[model samples]
Target chain A: MSAFNAQRITAMQWLSRQLLNQDVAGRYFDPLIEPLNPRWALGRMIATVERIEDETHDTRTFVLRPPRRWRGFLAGQHVTLALDINGVRHHRTFSLACAPETWQREGLIRITIKRTPEGLVTPWMHKNLYRGGALEISEAFGNFLLPDVEAPLLYIAGGSGITPILSHLESLACREYTAPITLIYCIRSAQDQIGAQQLEQLQHKLPLLNCQIIRADQGEGQPPRLLQASDIDSIKNIQARHCYLCGPTGLMAVATTLLETRDVPEEQVFQTFFAPLTNPLTDTAGGAVTLMRSNRELTVDSGQSLLEAAESAGLSPRFGCRMGICHQCSCRKTTGTVVNRNTGHVSGPGEETIQLCVSVPQGPVSLDL
Target chain B: MKTLNETQLQRLETGLDAIREDVVSDLGERDARYIRRIIRLQRSLEVAGRILIPLSLTPVGFVAGTASLSLAKIIENMEIGHNVMHGQYDWMNDPALYSQDYEWDTACDSNSWRRTHNYEHHTYTNIIGKDRDYGYGLLRLSNDTPWRWRNLFQFADYVGLSVLFQWGVGLHELEYEKLLSGEISLRDKGGFLKEFFRKGGRQFFKDYVFFPLLTFPVAGKVLLGNLSANLARNLWASTIIFCGHFTEQAATFHEADCENESKGQWYYRQLTGSSNFTGGRWLHLLSGHLSYQIEHHLFPDIPAHRYPEMAPRVQALCKDLGIPYNTGSFGRQYATVVKRILRFSLPERLTRQAA
Candidate 1:
C-alpha cells in the first residue's frame, strides 16, 4: 500500500473510532458507522429510495440517496443492489440510468430495472419496492462508458440494456456534445422500450443525435427483422463510427457476429451485456446427487446451482461473494459433469474443484462435500 | 451462593421470562441509533487521541495526550470491540457493523476471540471446567475450581495480568497447558501461533515503535507516554472484566447442572454467574457497559447501551422474585474480587469454615 493510503486508512480508523466514541457526533452518526461494523472495511453503502418512476410496463427507475460517504459515480457504471428475502441476501447489478451530472446537482442516483420472468431479485423489487424503501448498494463500478474518442458513436441497445446507454446519452446531451451519435434501440415491442420518452426528449435537446426504433416482435409492421446481418448493412458509415452493443443474449450474439463479419476493428467495438453472456446449456435437468464424504444423497432441481441444492438438502456449505469472485465456496466435484454458469465451461468427470455457487450439475453427480 | 427451594426457583424463572419479553420487544431504531452513535464517538476519540500523543513536549500536553489516548483505547476495547464482537449489532444489516466480520484494534485476533469468548465463554458462562474465561485458567475464582499449588502466586499473577491484559487475551487461545501436557502438538498450534504473532506484532510496532520513532527528538518521553497509556488501558480493562465474574457473590456452576436447561433456568444462571458495577454514564462507557454484566450475559446480542434501562426493570423483578442481583460500586466489587482471588489461592479445607 502507498504511504498516503496507509496514513489515510489510519486517519479513517481514528475518525471512525471518534465517531464511535460516546460523544454527540458518535450519537447522531451512529446509524451510519454502527459499532458492529469495522471502520476500515468497504462495507455496503445504504441508500434510501427517494422516488420511483415507471419507464415501461415491466421496468421502473428508482432514485436513491446514498449515505454521505458515498463517492460520486461515473456516468455508465453499474452498481450491485442487495436485498434480503427469506433471510438470504440477494444481489442484482444494474447500470446507473441517471447521468453523473444529476447526481452531482441533486445528490440523487438512479437504476432503471426491467423485470425478468425467472429473476428472483427483479420480480421481488417490482412487487415490493415503494418510495422511501431502503436498499444496500455497492460503489459504482464497470468500464462501459464512452471513452475519450473523436469518432462518431453508434450505440445499439436492446431491452433493458438501454439503461447505461441512456446514461451516456444524457451525459452527452447535458454537455451539448457536438459529435454526431446514432442509437438503434431494438425491443420486442415498441411499448416495451425503456427510456422511450427520454430518447424523444434527447433528440430535440441533442441536435447531433439520431435515434432509430427497431421493434422485432412478430406483430410489428417492419417485417420483424430480428437483428440479422442485413440490419448491419442498413446502417450507413458503420465502419467509421465507434460501435457499442448491450442487450439480451440473442441480440448481442447476432450483433457481435454481424460486426465481426463486417471487419470492424475489435478495439472500436465496445460491448457490455447486462444479461448472461455465457453459452446456453441445453441440459439443465439436474438429477439426484450424492455427497460422498458426508454420505448424503439429494435431488438437484433443474437449473439450480449446486450450492442452492445442497442448502435445500439441509447442508451448509461455506461461501462468500457468491458471484464466483471469492472462491470460498469451491468444493471438490469427485465425479460429475457440471456446467460453470459464469464461464459456460463443462467440467469433465474427474476429481476437480468447482465453485458450488455458480456450478450447475448436468446429471447425477458426486461431490466430496 | 445460597441454594433456592423449588418455589423460589420457579418465581425466579417467571420473573426472568417477563424481563426477556419486554426487552426483546423494545429492540428498535432507538437501540440501533444508540450503538451507531457510540461507534462514531469512539472513532473520533481514537483519531484525536493518536494525533495528540506525538506533541507531548509540555507536561500538560503529555498528560492530556496520554489521557485522551487511554480513554480512546478503553472505549474501543470495552464498549465498541467487546460488545460488537458479541453479535450485538448484526441485526443492523450494515456490513461494517456486522458482528461476524468486525476486527477490533487489539492484539487478540478476532476469529480466535470468537472461538474463546463468544462461543466458549458466553455459551458456558461461569461453568467451572468448560469455560476457559472462568479465571482465564489461572486464578481459582470459586470453590468449584479445585485448589492448585501454583495458584498460591495469584496475587502477583493478577498484577502481571493487569499490566499486560491485551497480551494475556492474545495468548488466551494458545492452550499452552494442553501442549505442555502432551494433549496437543506444536504442529497443531502452528496456525494459531502464526496468527497470534502477526496480530501481536502489529500492535507492538504501533504502540512501542512506530509512533515513538516518529518523535525522534523526544523519543524517550513520547515512548514512555504511549507505554503508560497502554498500561492504563490494560489495568482498567482487567479490573472491569475481573470484577464482572469474580466478585464475592457471583456463582459458578457444574456443567452437569446445565443439561437441557430451559430459557428461564439459563437466564437464572446468567443472573447469578455475573456481577455488575454501578456508575454514571462516563463510567458505563469506560467499562464498555459491562457495569451491567448480568444484563449483558442474559442478552449478549443486544446493544450494551440498552442494559442500563434494562437493569432497573431486571432489578425490580429480582426483588419481587427473591433472586439475588449481584451488583455494587466499582471499588467495592473490585475489592471483593481481590478477596475472592486471594481466598481461593489457599486450599478449600482451610477457607471452608470461614465461608
Candidate 2:
C-alpha cells in the first residue's frame, strides 16, 4: 500500500512480463504451481470458495475469497466465473451480490446462483463445488452502476434478479444514504425469495426504504399476478426517481413500458440482462458451411451459432466464453457473408475474423476451421 | 487388398462417422484431467532431473537424472506437445492446451509443425511425393519411388537421422530438395530459417548452456546429462514415428491414385498406409498414443488417449469391410520397419530377383 512498495510492484510486473511472457511462463509454471495450490495462477485470477450458503431450495450463495491483486467491482457489476467441469471449461456471468464495501474491507465477495434444471453449469455448481474449491473469475463488468447524484432510487427485481439489487441496497446502507428508496421484489412463491433477511436489515438501516415482496404465482389454476402499473404508480414521485431493473425479459418489458408511459427520462433508466438476448436470425434457415481445414461441409441452421453447429457436426473448434465476450473462438472466414448475433452487424464477402459463437452464416460460407 | 463399391464405401463412412461422434460427445472432465495429470508429471520429472543432475555426488545420480530428463522430454514431445498441436484438446478451451498458442520444448516450431505435419502429412498420409513424412526424404521405405544410388548408404543416414531427429523435423518444412534443385533460393526461406533458428537456439541454450552453467562446478557433467537425455529422446521419437508408417505391411499411394478420393476411400488409405504396434499402457503413453497409428491417421484430431479405446472399434469395422488392419508386437513392427528400409536400399528389380 505504500508508494515505494507500489512502485516496486509495478516494476516487478513489467520485468516479469518482459522476461517471462504469459504464454511461456504460464504453460510451465501453472502445471507446477497448480498441484501445490490450485488457487495460484500466473496469468489468471483464481478465487477460493470461503463458504456456501443455501438461500433457497434452488438458490445458493457462494462467498469467495479472491486474491490480493483482484481489482474490486462496482456494487451492481457482474463477473464471469470459469469452471472446468468434466474437463471442459464453461463460463457464466453472475452478479456480485455483496456490496463493494464488503469486498474492499473483507477481501471477499458473494455470488448467488439459481439452479436451472436443464442448464449445464448451474446444476453442476450446486452439486459439486465445495468449500476450498478454486474458481477462475474475470474482473467485474456491466453498466448497472449507481448514479452519482442524490436522487430517489427505485429498484425492481424478479426472482433471482434480486442479486444485483441486493448489492445496490447493501452498498447504499453502508453509505448511510437516507434518500427515499422503493424496491419491488417479485418471485413465484414466498420460499423462492432470496435475501429476505438482508432486505429487512437494509430497510431498518435506511428509514425511507420501502420494500414490497410480490408473488406472481398465486395458486394452482389462478391467473398469475404479473407486474402491473399499480406497482409503479403506488410509489411516490416514481417519475422522478432513478430506476434500476433486473429480471426476466417479460417482466423488464412490462416495467419499461410502464416507466415510459409515466414520462420517466430514458437516461435515468438502467437495466442489465442476465441471459444473452435472442438473436434476430433464429428463425431463418441457414446455408451451407465449408470447413476448409478439415475439408468437410455441413449445413448449419440459423438457429444455432457456428460454434454450436461445428460441435454438433463432430468438429471441435477452439472457443471460450460462448457468449461473444471472449475472442477465443474467432476464426478467419475466407468467403461469404455472416451476421454477428450480438450486434446484428453483417460482414462483407471478404477474408475477415469472425467469432464463431455469435456468427451465423447468411449464405454459403467457407471458414479456416 | 479389397476394394469397396459405392454402397459399401458409404456404409464404411457411416460406421466411422458414428464411432467419431460417440467419442466426441463423451469428451469431458475425464479427458481433461488425464492431459493435465500428464503435464504435471512431465514438469515434475523435468524439475527433478534438472536438480538431480547438478547436485548429485555419484554416477547413479547422473544416470537417474539423464533418464528422468529423457522421459520428460519424450512425453512433452509425444503425448503432450504432438497431440495438443494436432488440436486434440482444442475443445477444452484451455489457453495452455490450445493448438495455436502452444509451444513445445523441441527444436521444431509449432507453426511449422502445424503446417507440415498437421496439414500436409495428415492430409496426404502416405502418398508418395505428397506426404513428406514418409521416410522424411532421407531413406527409401517403399518401391513406389524410383531408386537412387545414394540410397545404398541410407542405412547410415537412418542412424544419423534418428540421433538428430528433432533437427530433422525442424528443417522439414524448408523443402531442402527444392533448395538443392534451385527451385527455391535461401532468400525465399529467410523467414522460415529465422523461426527455425530462434526456436532451435532457445532449445539448445536451455539444454546445453543455461542449465549446465547453473551448476558451474559440475558444468561438464550437467552438459553431458542434457546431451544424453536429448539424444535418447530423439532416438525414441524417431523409432516410434518410423514404426507407424514404414513397417513392412504399411502401403504407399500415388498422388494420381488418391486424387478426388471420397471420405471412405481416404479412411481406407489411412488404415492401410499406417501400422500399429501392440504395447502396454506405458509404451503407448510414452509414444503419445502413436502406437495406435491406424486410429491416429483416421481420427487425428481426437485425443490420442482415446485411440486405445477406438482401435478395437476401428479394427472391427476394418474386419467387417474386409480391409487390412495392420498391427503387430512392438518388436516385430520395428523389425519389419528395418527390413523395409534394408529391402528398399537396393533397386526394385534386384530386390525382387533376390526374393
Candidate 3:
C-alpha cells in the first residue's frame, strides 16, 4: 500500500468509471484483458486461488489472493463466490475463515467450504477447481462480526459453522486480547470437526480461551444430542458473556431460547443461519405494493404474484414464462419482504432482485420496476 | 400440408410443451459450459483480429484479419447478443448474460431489440401488418401487402438493407412508416432517437474512429479493415435471418385471423411462419442457432444451443400433427429466400404464387 500504488489505483478507478459510464469500455476491454489475466476486470472483483487444503472429507479451505482493489474485511464477514462450473456461473456465500491481519500481511483470505452432496456449486468446486483457477467474488458483507469491547464471549458453532468463530478467535489471539472466551464447537462426529488445528493454536495463544468440542452422536441406536439448557448454564457467568451463535436453525433457536431464559439481553445474543429457511406460506395476503419506477401502488391478495399485480396496474415490466421459469421478470425489491412462490424462500427486507412472476409480497413492498 | 384441427393443435401444444420442459429442466453445467466456451472463442478471435488488422502491411494479414474480425462480430451479434437478448440465458442470472443488462457490439441497442424482436415479432409471427419483422416493412415477401410502384425495386432495397443491416435494425424501433404517415411525430421519438444515436454512435466511433486512430501508423488500413469486417458480418447476419423467415415455404397470417389465439394456435402459427436451414454445427453456431427458427420462435427463452436437440423432436411432433415443418439445405433455403424476394418484387399476377 505505497503512496505511488495507491495513487495508481485511484487513477485506474477513475478511468474505469469514465470508461464504464455506459459499459462501452467494459464491453470492448474486458474480453481482451480477461484472456490475458482473468483476475483483472473493470466491473467485477476477481480473485485467484493461491492454495487449497483439505480440512475434512467433505470440507476444504481455499486460500485466495484478491485483486488489488479489494478492501479487506473484518474477521467474521462473508463473501459471495461466483464459480463458473461447466459453463454457468453459480454464486454461493461463505464466511471468510481468516483474521483480517492475515489479509493485511499476506494479501490473502481463506474460505472454508463444506461440500453438500446434492448441491450444484460446492461439488463442482471440490472436483474441478484447481490451485490456479480464478473466481469472481463480492466484497465482504454480513453483520456477524466481532464486538469492539473486551467483553467475555461465548461462541456456539455447529458443524461447518466453526468457520466464522475460528476467524473471531484468531483475530482475538492476534490482538493479544485476554478476555475470557468460551467456544462450544458441536459436530455430528469427530471426523466432521473442522479447524481443529486452528482452535488448538488459538487456545495456546489466548490463555483464557476455553475450547470445547461436542459430538452430537453418542453411540449406536441413540438419538442425537443437540444444544441443551445445560450447555449455556454451564458457561461461567452465562448472563454476563456476549453469546455468538452460528449453526443449524434448530440449534440456533434452542440456544437463543436458553440464553433468553437465563436473562441474557436480546442484543447480546447474535446469530447467523447457514441454511436458507423455508418461509411459511401464510401472511402473504392483502399487502400494498409500490412500483418505485412508475410511482404506482396497488393492493394484492396472496394468490396474485407481483407480475400479475404490476400488469393489472398497467405497468409493463419485462417478463417471460409467467410460471417463473425464466428470470426475465426479475427486478429489485427495494423494501419489505416477498416470498418466492416457486421455492417458498422469504427474501430479506433489503434491496435484492426477485422474479416478479413467482414472488408474492408478504408485506408492504417497493419494487424498482 | 393440411391444416390441423382443434384436437390436433392441442396435441401439438402438449408435445412442444413437453419438449421445452425437458430441455429447461436439464439445463445446467453442460449448457452453461457451451455458451461460455463460445464466448471465449469469440473473444479470442476478436483479440487476434484487432492485433492483426493494424499489421495489414501484407495482403495475407489484411485478408485474415478482416475475416477473423468478421467472424468474431458475427458470433458476438448473432450467437451471443441476439440469443442472450432474447432472455435465453437469463436463467443463469449471470450479469454478463442477463438480457436486460447486456448491451451488444452491434448498433441495435439491447432494450429496443428485446421490445421489437422478442415481444412484437415473436408474439405476432408473420401476421402481415403486425410483425414488422415479416419483411422489416421494406421488402414485399408476401402478396398480403398490396403491390406498390416501389415493389419493382425492392430487390435493390433488400441488398442495401443487408449491407447496412445493423443500422437498419438499430433504427427499426423508430417505426418510419408511422412517422411518414403522420401517425406519430418525430418529437414523440426524441428519447428513442437519443438512445439509438448513443448506441449506434459508440459503435460508429469504435470501428471508424477509435480503433483506426489507435493504429495511427496504419490508420487507413485499420479503418478499411474494420469497415470490411462490419460489412461481412452485416451481410452474413442478414442472409441467415432472411433464410429463416422470408423463404418461399414460410407462411404469413393476417391480424384479423390471429385474434384471441390459443396457445395451440400460437404454436401452430410459429410453426408455419418460420423456416429452418439444415447445416453442420459451425453453420448452426454461426447462425446463432436461428437455423432452427421454428423452435426459436416457439421457445425464445431456451438456450439456442439446445435448439439443435429440440429441433428433431419439434419436427417429429409437427409431422404427426399434420403441421408444415419448413426446412431444407442452407443453399436451398437461401435460394428460395432470393426467389421469394425477386418474385414478390413484380406484380402478383405477373409472377406465379408460391404453393
Candidate 3 residues B54-162, lDDT tens each?
A: 9867899889999999999999998998998887887675777877677778888777888888889988889888899988888888878889999899989999999
Top model by TM-score, which number? 2
Tens digit per residue, CA lDDT, model 1, B136-197: 87778877878888889989999998999999999999876677889888899888999898
In candidate 2 chain B, what residue range of length 10 has the lowest lDDT sum? B1-10
DockQ of each: 0.06, 0.54, 0.27
Query: What tens-digit string does per-residue lDDT give for candidate 3 at A1-369?
Result: 699998887776554333232343464566557767877875687899999999999999999999999988997888877776555555677899999998999999999999989877788888888898888888887888888888999999998888988888889989998779999988999899899888888889999998878888999999987778777777888877888999887778788888888999898888874553344345557489988645678898876789888878745466544555436578898999988876778889999999997899988999986
| TM-score of each model, in listed order | 0.67, 0.91, 0.84
lDDT of each: 0.79, 0.88, 0.84
TM-score of model 2 (CA atoms): 0.91
* lDDT of model 3, residue A59: 99
- Model 3 ranges with Cα > 4 A deviation: A1-60, A63-69, A85-87, A105-108, A115-134, A188-191, A213-240, A261-265, A279-281, A286-330, A333-369, B352-355
Give the TM-score of chain A in candidate 2. Answer: 0.86
Docking class of 1: incorrect
Residue-level lDDT for B116 in candidate 1? 89
Ordering by DockQ: 2, 3, 1
How would you encode candidate 2's per-residue C-alpha lDDT over A23-101 as one tens digit per residue? 3356467888866776677668789999999999999999999877788998899998988988888888899998999
Taking chain A of model 1 alone, its TM-score versus the true chain A equals 0.74
